[model samples]
Target: MPSVPPFPRASSRTHSSPVYRQRIRHTVPAAGCLAVLLFLIAFGSSTVSAQPADPAEHVSSTEPSTSSLSSPPQTIAFTGGAWYDGTGFVNDPLYIENGRFIAERPASIDTTIALDRHFVVPPFAEAHTHRIDQKGTLEGAVDAYLADGVFYVANLNNIPAFANPLRDTLDRENTVDVALAHGGFTSPGGHPQPLYERLVDRGIYSDWTKEQLAGQAFHAVTNSEELRTAYETIRADEPDLIKAYLMFAETKNASGLTPAVLAELVEMARTDGLRVSVHAQSANDMHIAAEAGAHQIAHMPPMPFQHDDGEKWYLIPDSTAQLLAEREVSVVTTTVLADGFDDGERKERVRSIQRENLSTLHDAGVHLLVGSDTWGTGQNEALYLHGLDVFDNQTLLRLWTDTGRSIFPDRAIGRLAPDHEASLLALTCNPLSDFTCVEKIDLRIKQGYVIELPPQTTSSP
Candidate 1:
């Protein structure tokens, strides 16, 4: 078992709800990468099962395997392509050595792939999403993301039971690299509570009891004391980044953390050197999160909420956008989520708000990241934003590539430059002229290795 962090002792509160006090039991076996491969080879199914009666019996004590380290570095050359260099595409022959772009050509080349004058761009990234977290959705989601030319993903809120096993499986040559925010912090019975319960109701997690799922799904911290207690589990979970939720902060009895509590949580996360991504559901939520020193706002306040006075228009004030821009906190564009609203009038209303908010944020110089935050990849979000006519093709490209990669700053990816990770997508048409051409991926390359997909899906590198 991993040791928990020793946080400073604080006064306690007696909470009756299990979501607030129940200690999480990490039931997933830590067998790591080898188990994933073996399981796939044996069952050919991506859905992982719950641990057996003796869960500890299967936890492997060995170190996770690093297949890339033992293999000798290979040199590959991509010729005759117009690669995007941040601003625009330049006709240049790119070289790769040991899974990274190289300025100097190697003496010996292992293979040469001709790009056939295709448009080469850094692979797309998802800054905020939960599509790749669950076992039932993992395999198909990965295939869809790669087929759409998206190579980087972030699982914003997931349980360790499902996410921990795949920690070693992703960020490899063949799979989409992921950054997991295992179990977000939310108010008791807040946004994700209903989300997870619906999954169980839909038989997506039929085997899981609500009690077993609640503790693993989210930390229900309402005050400073609750925040400190949750830190113990935060350390145990070892999240890549901290996740905070702020919804309807202006409401009288909203189901979210207070401004003071959120500030405390942000301070703690900053002290621990972890970036914080806050889920903001409304303009007030976004303002509160930015003021609390959140590094990223997971959403652009896409949906409107019923205010205390029954107003539904959720528009971000110019001052709030300026604050976010001044703080340099990137906001993810999940405006596509509003497309699924059943009410046509409500959908149009939400879309109007999204367009206004996006323009405001863009004009204020606030960085925006591309993310669908739905079952699909970031391509859909990119298309939606393009349709809004706020951002040009080049700006959207940079947001999906460069800004999106900022979610996981530790990785050297999302750029077609020397010493950057050698992952790119080749499209048959110039995406700059026709934005739709981005969906037409001709070839995919990841980590200096050729990636082969099914026919009509994508070609080999």
Candidate 2:
């Protein structure tokens, strides 16, 4: 395979920069707003453990418990707003106690936030991103993601040595929540191996040898033994999910995992209680992944129809669509990157095929999730913006909210329900009316900690 372009890297000097600099843009209120203060009071008095809990039990505790008279859980009521609770919108008063929604309001409310003529929905998730690397660090990727109203992100392509430390640091610092696939399984000299090799040559990953980088950074398994070793190595990292690549053999020089191997990998992942997300770019590979029982397809496959030069084009076949739906495999629609393709007849043709592919998958009853697959930098903040061109407002919203919940089902995200996390985005304009309204976030509430954003400034004409 030809050497891919050198991946961006952060200078060693950049690593010494204060981490606080990354979060400087976010203005944390000194005493917080009424809602936030109430939340803190309730959270402090509640019995909810700080550690992770089962999703079904994420709601407020009902068991009576003695607390100091000076610090009782405060009841806060949010009235006069339309809430999108994942499935539909409802205009009602939502109550919160101990950082969780409650069905009934307390006899006496401590505070109330007037939300008249506003829309409240769960913060979004970027499901198929790859910005957890060093370069993204310098770019303030995590902070940018949070500022964009993304509460959670799945780093699909990860290098354990690099990703795990970064993830741990972020977790300890209470930054953003990230679901990681700590290095995916790929065939020998496969899709990402060539790219990773380039990064090493550029001195980005100079510390590790090529063999050490393989499998951990980009697995290049050629047989069962290699696959076994790679799987165990990745498993040691305790990944949230497992990822594998399945590209057509003829399309590129690098060899891809065969259907049999892919199936085995899926079985291994499931046996270990992990979900598998396969990277497949063509109908043939997609079919293999579906049949192998992969839980998610990282990208929407190219249309089944082929051009005269053998490039795949047009919409996917009905059979494939039905199989995908039956398997209940969600597709992460990462079509935003396609916009970077050089403008030409070929680009338009590919774009048309991709648009049709996503629409057909959606129509086929397959869950569509949003992902930018971009570096989540200032320049790439438009990840969620461009998708509006192809999908309707409601569909895109669901992709960003509901479908994303499927990735980390145990987390209290993607919904505004009793026990769900209090992370939410408040907008003056209803997104259902015009999705662009999402860009105008009036307030961002994450884990009940509110951060009021500064008003957007329009560029001078």
Candidate 3:
């Protein structure tokens, strides 16, 4: 069980919905990746079940025990290959059991299916998303990224009342595994003040009050006595992670937790076995949280993060950036927010800006994760949060799948390695090369069942 930041209390009016958000194979010296993928698809459809599904359903969690896999899913052999199975550069002779890899064959030649050929990167992960559940019922937004090879999502449960059940359902189904935060706690008038205030006014939430809207209630403990109590209180619930909103986003006088307070929170949380996700947008706040040893920074602000210089564009000072890199603190850029609008090309321009920044962060060796804080209305419909070229479905898929897996290493996401949970995607093409191929997602297999693809039928030999 992990404790996370609480979602901004919204009005009775619901905010965002999830329904948004690839592929391929190998060849002989000239057969091409597409050819190999087609062969594998035809072969796989022979023994496996590729059932039609909602674009957003979670995958199965069961890993075929070595016992069950004595005779595994039919293996496919492709050539001229490129793969990322934790081990780089695998040329053909790869085995795909169910959807997980089985073994590799050398110098391929046998069947129509190909494996070790085309680039086979791992599936993507969505570090910060509010996805729907398997039941089609809703506590929060649903995820529509299944067909695109996004194997897992780090859904933020800012609203436990709604999030807990959804998380439970995912676990029960062994569907898409979720690394979740219980809910973001906030001081009554904190960043979410407006959203929370609206909900109360609309009679949507009964526990509405200005005081409860602050940032402190959600994270900060005023004194040592409260500090100990806070740790125990959170400990009782047993959480996988803890998140803190250190800033006062909407206030006329925006503020953040004092350095001392933030330091205390980090220390206390670490002792209690909790990883921290700090919501710090500005460089000042980001550096502070970093110094305090926060594990991940929630979002990159509209501008580059910088020190006290106070430039118009948000920027991170060299020193702070270096420190963050050295500490290996991951920065999750939820570029979707800034790029959500289509205001006379304004959104597109913002998307461009984000691309440059994201690329820089990536080059800097900063573990950057793609997160579309697709909260609020119509957030997921922007075509691609961080997809193709700048924001296409392809880029989005890889970013979330392969890119996001590292965020939670212990979870073992992104690949179909031996003894790993069976999370895979069978798209129309190999997503590793042209992300655009994710648009070709013909099947999305979770544990073993095909999730969002058309049902597979036996094909004529």
Candidate 4:
């Protein structure tokens, strides 16, 4: 294996900085499988306790809570692991108090987990997905994400009626944190319209008709008047961010939102203190979205499957890449969706295009976020990116850790340091040596609370 990079030390007290060593003498245990030991350090002696209850029942908000008999320990220590500092790992003792990482120990220790010198990294995040918006399907997605160590998710498309009522079920310590872009702005006959229509045809939404799903599934607007009214309606619902659709906006007579309308929407979202994330299907769509000052491009342009066939419309030009970087816009790599191309030659061609586009965007200094547009978690997206050979193991790890910024910019997450969220994954091996080690998480922690799961039937990372 190649050598891991040196741990970059912090220059100041910022939470973004790497760990500054503070050695404390303690007896180190022999190497063994990770073990959970709860100790009430109020007095001199230690006491053992059973595993904590599900964190969902204890925490209602993002804030940490005091540990009760039903909740996990609030003041705890995770010792004997190589903690990832967003760049490299360092052997250290990580202390948590009140669901936040603290540099020093608290007055009283509530619990301790011995990692046995495993590799610890920040919890994973999914920057794009539409799976966690339904009432009946939310629990399954949450369980899958937690089992995969994906602590954060960004639901890029949803029906407010179906998704809004279920917001209270997530963003807690037990469940994965979520940000919803309810009912994206699209043309009358745009991308997601067809997708939802198909679902309705299949009986997934047995009650709703195609006419009723128009505004409920997506907001359709053509002129400035419709755009203004639609924006107001969505803003009243209070989405985490705004979602816009631009399908081949640069192409002549394209059936999507125009640049003027998208630009206006971006301005409105900014005025309301919300960011705009645009779903762009082609290179022209991406360019237009960036020019309109959209905060994020939901996907890297994929090869056209149904429309605009027989042309490399998805290939991003150098000038557009430069403009995207200049605009400070982030792009989510949903390149894994291209794997469904059944034709061997077409699949390889798409792969070549994907490799070139990823290289171009990375070279232009554009921020690339990891996201699986499928029902799966971000782990699959990271693995697919690895197959593209566009990024190495270290780069993939960093991108996965940094995904929280695109979903929740104000909160301190996607890093392991003082003042950051107390959430992480402890793997059995070094991911720097083998990227697949990320799937081998032995323990998962979120908000100073331990997340216990049933035995898995699948293979390890």
Score each candidate by Cα lDDT.
0.70, 0.61, 0.47, 0.76
TM-score on alpha carbons, each prediction: 0.81, 0.77, 0.65, 0.86
Q: How would you encode candidate 4's per-residue C-alpha lDDT over 345-439 as one tens digit per residue?
A: 77777778888899999999898999978888888888889889888788889888899866899998988899988888877778888888887
Clashing pairs in 4: none
lDDT-based ranking, best first? 4, 1, 2, 3
Model 1 C-alpha RMSD vs. true structure (Å) is 16.4
Q: Which residue runs does candidate 2 get wrong by more than 4 Å?
A: 1-75, 107-111, 134-139, 169-174, 206-211, 249-254, 303-314, 377-390, 452-461
- Tens-place lDDT per residue, model 1, 344-427, is 777777777788889989999998899878777888888888888887888888788885468668778888989988888877
Error of 4 at 338 (Å): 1.4
**How would you encode candidate 3's per-residue C-alpha lDDT over 78-103 as one tens digit per residue?**
33334444433243234544344455
After superposition, candidate 4 runs with Cα above 4 Å error: 1-70, 303-311, 455-461
Tell me model 1's lDDT, rounded to 2 decimals: 0.70
Q: In angstroms, give how far residue 6 of model 3 lies from its true place.
A: 50
Candidate achieving higher TM-score, 1 or 4 = 4
Candidate 2 matches the true fold with a TM-score of 0.77
Question: What is the C-alpha lDDT profile of model 2 across 1-461, one tens digit per residue?
Answer: 11112212222322232221112122222122122111222222223233233322322232111110111224456655578855556765467665566677666444345454557778777778777654335225545555566667788877877777564334211245677887778776777888777878887764766767765777767678888888887888888898888776335543578777888899999998899988876766777789999999887744222233344523577678789999998887766565566556756676677777776787899887777676642123233334436676666676777744776787767778877766677666577776766655555666544443332312100
